[model samples]
Target chain A: MINTEKIVEVQNLNFSYGQVNVLSDVNMSIHLGEFLAVIGPNGGGKSTLVKILLGILKPDSGKVRVFGKKPGTSKSVGYVPQDFSAGRGFPVTVREVAMMGRALAGKGTTKAEDKDVVDKILNDLTLIDSSEKRMDDLSGGQRQRALMARALAVEPEILILDEPASNLDMIGQTRIFDLLAQLNKNMTVVVVSHDLTIIPKYATSVACVSGNVHKHDEAEVTEDMIHQSYGGVEGCPVELVAHGHPHRVLKEHDH
Target chain B: MMELLSFGFMQNAIMASILASVACGIIGSLVVVNRIVFISGGIAHTAYGGIGLAFFLGISPLLGAGVFAVTAAVIMALITKDNKYRADTVIGAMWAFGMAIGIILLDLTPGYNVDLMSYLFGSILAVPKSDLVYMFILDGMIIAYILTWYRQIHAVSFDSEFASSMGVRSDLIYMSMLVMSALAVVLLIRVVGLILIISMLTIPPYMAERRSNSLKGMMIYATLFSLVFSLVGLVMSYFFNLTSGASIIFVSAICFFLSLIYDRVRTSK
Candidate 1:
């Protein structure tokens, strides 16, 4: 059974970029404590959907609700942006960037507890040694973890990452997924990724967004669903191959 | 240099330098970090239209420029904040238009004999005590705004999307910073003319960014750097009998190249 608590709900959501139809009638419901992987092809509105949920971009029509309120209302949703290098050259320290996550931690004021929280996150992410180092000075993997530490410092209920491991290699991607899986045990996690193989391994629920959104619990994902969701347009099934908790697999979907 | 400071005009120039340098320091770090240097240049140049309008109406030309600059800054900020590729074309068009208006208006002013070169290139030595008050007020405005809202500015500048997710009102903060920079550019005109304001706003901050670890550190260090550059430029102007604005920019440009060399060596190490 799905978790009873509804953390995110999207209804009839439509968004566009100057006449380009990005999202059309996208509807989905996310339950609490579920590691949701939002997968799709490139330029298929995955980032756009996440942006709407983050309240950075508004929809052309329809509603986006988080915790039974507007997406930006709660400030409980932590976000890891896609482009880690957006403003990296601005001379801000890693700790300073992480502290930005604390903006909504305590009613717009930093308490002693907030500092403790940041310190713990830095240490856990193995970023304590480089906390004072400039953001641009860190390696790509280190920067990603730093950003994750920043988001986790918010102590959010729902954490969303936009293609967290895009530029990373297979090993790097698995490392990130491992971290996300650990984080999901305590809080709801939503990751938008093009890595199809991660669905069965890490995600509790899958939301495939390609022009539209289709939500599938672990048991509902099938070869036809995977094909239509990802490989459908190319007249093939975009097969995902990975392993985690043992589950029965359809013989036909097996590659 | 001491003899130069003894004169009223030089004293006023020094005061103007302090006021403008501080404003540029605080505001310039933002301009460079936010990558809005080109937009600021656009605002500075567009302010020339205001100067022309003010002259046409027989009012204070500086006041006209301030109003025009702020307006241009806000508009340019809105248009180019997200779309930077279109910035040069938009700013270049406005730059040419502003100069055209200023030239035509100055031509129309009956018996107007003010040296147009002074406005094009700055004549900091000609600034009077009265203009210092405006500089101080504008300086106060920029400082108070940045200090009162440092967290918001810091968050928004580093990563606006994350800031917005944290309910920082990133767009509002972005607009306010751009508008504040517009006002700062207005005050800066007395030191460096509209033509040279971009370099004045960016050079010290660019050098400071390479050394400092935080935005606050960058702002403070950049201010000191600007102060030194202006002082050295002023002294060089007195000795070489060159245009003060051009000399100041020359000093800043030289420091900029040197900082690049230093950063290259350090990073290579």
Candidate 2:
């Protein structure tokens, strides 16, 4: 039974690309302001699931809804598509790129006030100095932030991200996580990541994906679960707290 | 040179160049920004099929090319939509087939060993009054479309997926762009031959892109640059007895090179 209050609802969702089953019978519901982290191994249909939710791809069978409407209806869904090709040499100004988020907001003419709004967004994202610079001139971390600024300008009620922190360093990663935490305070946010370390600190609920679906309810993700989810290695230390209970990560290991 | 401009043919060539350049430059800006240069090139060449059909059917070649290119542009637009990456391959195949069919049809058209060179290579020196009227109408339509939906076109050209998410039907906008580009190609077929049409389409904007920050600024500068290139090329062609179309493209090429040098020098400074 789907809760009517759910912002995103997916049931019996199966997706495949020409006989390769990526996801099967996946069921999940995300409530308003919920921060859900989907962690999985490579080739675990993480991106496939995100694309389906964004209405970019359709499932072979199942149901999906956004904000009590179709997947694409909520112009309020801000998706920063997995940065597959955002490299240097894409010739566009940071301000121009960010303005794209406001492209659909009932067009007439961009008033002088709209420029001020974009300027504020650039400042909030710490991109104000480089707003006039071409996208190709920005560093990788700055480029990622520019993409995020674009997404933020859309005023999305649901923010969906795919491996947004994969390219960032330790500082970059922490800054992005902090931003996500602040964003999730007001909107529903779903992030798909392969990283297991950052899941517990920020994710309100963790969903494990491995061609199958497993849901955990606010449980502190244990290292044993990570090992089980990622497939255990031979030399990795494993400790048992009790039968049927395992926790390998201690305070020292936590970043 | 001033006295030569008194002739109706010389005046017509000048008008044709100005009209065709403005239309092509504006449409070409969208093409370059969207990375649809090759597809626009394909549309320009494929217009030959329409010319051949017009000759065979005893109608105006411009009308025939207009009808045929518009139809093909729509089909090309549809096939390419939802598959932006693979669009060029489909357009390339269509371009080759369209050209082949046109040549075959031209050969089969009876009572017509018509000088194919004039149409294929362009005869700006021989442009008629009727052609000028046609150019005027096309120019009007182009201006209206650009004025009414300029912002939407800019957004779609920059990033279509983002545009569509914003309630703009990128499919519709993409199709409109293809149709307009094809029409512009059809208009330029007589001013500059199909062989040289894409150069006119690309060169002006390429030069303008170096000096401008916004797309609109690039287009306006391109129009002014194209006008200067056309006049210089015309005078050069008249004096040297060279082909008008080829001479025009040569002057534009020089401008493109100069623009590149200027940008390099400025950046170094």
Candidate 3:
């Protein structure tokens, strides 16, 4: 039973990076408890769409809203950026990073209840054992999980992640998607991923963004959609491996 | 050491070292973790413009540098925050531009032959009693700011984009951090001078980063390291007639290298 409550809405959004148009006349909406995978080619404005949704980047001309309010004005969104290791070598413990989520949610961790929330998040993410360890000491998978723990600690209604498993191994990627599947039971989950095969397994919907955005209400990744988003089969040689079946996701093309 | 402590000058120098250590220890950790050492260097060098302004206006040189440093920091923060790709080039230009202004202003000062070496290097032994009061206030302000906004600062330093998404006002926090760095530069200018300030601001925090698991712990450890380096460097300078600022930086550099070697050997084992 999907909730039809709209959590994110964008209307005629046009964005550019100094005249180089990234997103043009883009319109999309996300509902509550949605597991949306934003997929596109490199330099196709996937991350830009994520940033705009998170209010990190404002569209040049458009109306964007999250939780029925202007993006970034609401406190119900939790985001994990693409570069989770941006703070590598920073002197911060796993527990402290999770606690940052609490702080950001306008709830300082001084109270026992707040601390308990953070601890529970860390425990749920299987980061309890390494809670005292520095972020630099954690493996890539653990670091990804730790960042997830931080995002979850916000107790958000919507969770947005940009390339959460880009640096992980196959097993690690599976683990992260599985974790997202579990998390999607309660919150709206939006992810920007290049892993086309893994996305159909978990995402309830897909948004193929190039300079324009095409929203699919179903999880199925079609040949025409990929070809259109990637500027036809000649421009994109995408070999998608779904359920261990190695096959081209696009139409037949030259060798 | 006891005999030296009995002297007023020695007392002032020790006090100055402790206050300088406190500023560098707290602010320096943020500087190192954020990888903004170069921006800090820019602010320190830009402070010379303020020093020259002070001489020309017949005001306290420290005050001039403090005002100039904070102003430069705000400008740097604005430029770097928006135009990250070209930050280094802008900082380099500002660095040279600041020095040029200071040189011109000092040259135009009528009948005042300022000892350029004292400001370029440091004159810790010649620090006036009044400067100590300013240093104390600055340390207090830095501590209070950190305590008030620890979580925000931590978030911004770690992942600013994520922090911004979480309503942290990362740009504001980043600017504040830069302003604090500028103030820390003012605190250190008397102990290490403008040129040697970056080492004092970075080396101890870099060492502390490896040893601590939390930002607060790193700050404490860095502060302690800075205190030790300053005191030892001061004593060595007094006994050997060496430049105090250079001696302090040399001590920090040696320790930094030794820490590196120690980590490498331990890792190999």
Candidate 4:
């Protein structure tokens, strides 16, 4: 029987961009309060699937539900998109950027309460001191923190992240992982990342999708299983290769 | 002064400045925030082609400019959508193409002894009553649109994909922004002329950024600064016999420098 405790349910989800089919027959159920990490190679539909769940992109023929409602219709879902290397010049402050999520909450008439909610999120992110600093002036890690703070301002029951550790160095990546762990305690967290180093330790459940898809709960994750999914030969756990490339065992993952 | 106010042309200039200030201020804030200043500059200059087209077709220059500017804005938007690095290159090519086309068309219009300098530099003194009315209506639309759609606009400017994921229509929002920019560019050309229009569109918002937190507040401050500067410029132009557009830009530049100094002083403490 399907789990009644599920918060996110995707059934037979299929998606594509133009003629290229990215995701097909993807069915998954994420229980309430689960921390799920989605790891895949470059162009492996990781971002596409997360985008579908977040309502940024629609699946051709599938169902996606968040807390029993359509994905984007759920006010309780939060998202942090990959930092796409926007250059300097925009003069937005960190506080103002974070407030975007709160501003989008509900309809129009709740500005006062919205401010209070955003303030709380900033406090939780430890970003209160630098809130007034311009986003352009922030350090790389600080900018990422501000992005996280923006997502948290939604007070989401579920949080989605895409390549949260892409450009971060070791320290920055660790800090972001720690922050995600803290957030996972309060919400269902789903992360789409290619940083395989983080998967074994930080992830409670790991889902690998290339052409085919598979999932392993925290206890069920074995090194050989990771090698099989990622096609790392000679009995090493799957590791991120150079430049986000994947060497997989099965040609079926190449659809 | 009351005698000067009695002149219909003087009243038209005042109304035109007010209308132009509001449009330029709001749209300029978006341009500055989104870092599309150079593209907007290209759009303004490229609009000169429309003025030439209007002369050739015996239509109003404003109508030609409207069509020309919107077309340019869309082209620029599409070209720069996926390629941010090539923005300047594309804008430069379009800028030269627009000016060249305008000059060629203007030459082809026989017996057209046009006062081209007035179009290049604004002739606020010649602003028609009907144009003033158009400006007012457009300003009203800009105000209503900004207030009703502030959050969505802010989100798109900051993080488009995230905004899209939140169910905000980023594409619609982007198109609307371009349309507003087109309207602003057209109105600004009427009051400040194409040569000096970009300064008015960019300077006030640049000054306001030193003090404001949110885009909404930045826009209000920009409007106030633009209004004050344009008024001062108008009076100075009257007293000193200067070009209306250049005088206005001069005053805003002073404001920009002053705001910078004020920001530095506050931070030094």
The candidate with the higher DockQ, 2 or 3, is 3
Q: For residue B122, what is the lDDT in candidate 4?
A: 88
Q: How much does candidate 1 score in TM-score?
A: 0.93
Q: How many backbone clashes does candidate 1 have?
A: 0
Q: Best DockQ goes to which candidate?
A: 3
Cα lDDT tens digits, model 4, B102-131, are 889999998898889878888787788878
Model 1: DockQ vs. true structure:
0.57
Give the B-chain TM-score of model 4: 0.94
Would candidate 4 be rated incorrect, acceptable, medium or high by CAPRI criteria? acceptable
Candidate numbers, best TM-score first, in rank order: 3, 1, 2, 4
- lDDT by residue for model 3 (B3-67), tens: 99999999999999999999989999999988889999999999999999999999999999999
Chain B TM-score against the true chain B, each candidate? 0.95, 0.96, 0.98, 0.94
Q: Considering summed lDDT, which 10 consecutive residues are worst modelled in model 2 chain A?
A: A235-244
What's the ranking of the predictions by lDDT, best on top?
3, 1, 4, 2
| Clash pairs detected, candidate 1 | none
lDDT of 2 by residue, A117-137 (tens): 778889988999999887767
Single out the weakest 10-residue window by summed lDDT for candidate 3 chain A: A235-244
Residue by residue across B1-269, what tens digits does model 1's lDDT show? 56776898888888989998898889999999998887788888888889988988999888999888888877776777678357779888887888788889888988888777777778788888888998999999999998899988988888888887776788789889888988987898878888998999999998888889999999998999999999888878878899989999999999899889988999899
**Could you tell which candidate, 3 or 4, scores higher by lDDT?**
3
In order, the candidates keep a fraction of the true contacts of 0.55, 0.09, 0.69, 0.44
The 10-residue segment of model 4 chain A with minimum total lDDT is: A232-241
Model 2: per-residue Cα lDDT over B54-106, one tens digit each: 88888999998898789889988888876745777888988987788788888
Which of 1 and 3 is ahead in TM-score? 3
Candidate 4 all-Cα RMSD: 5.1
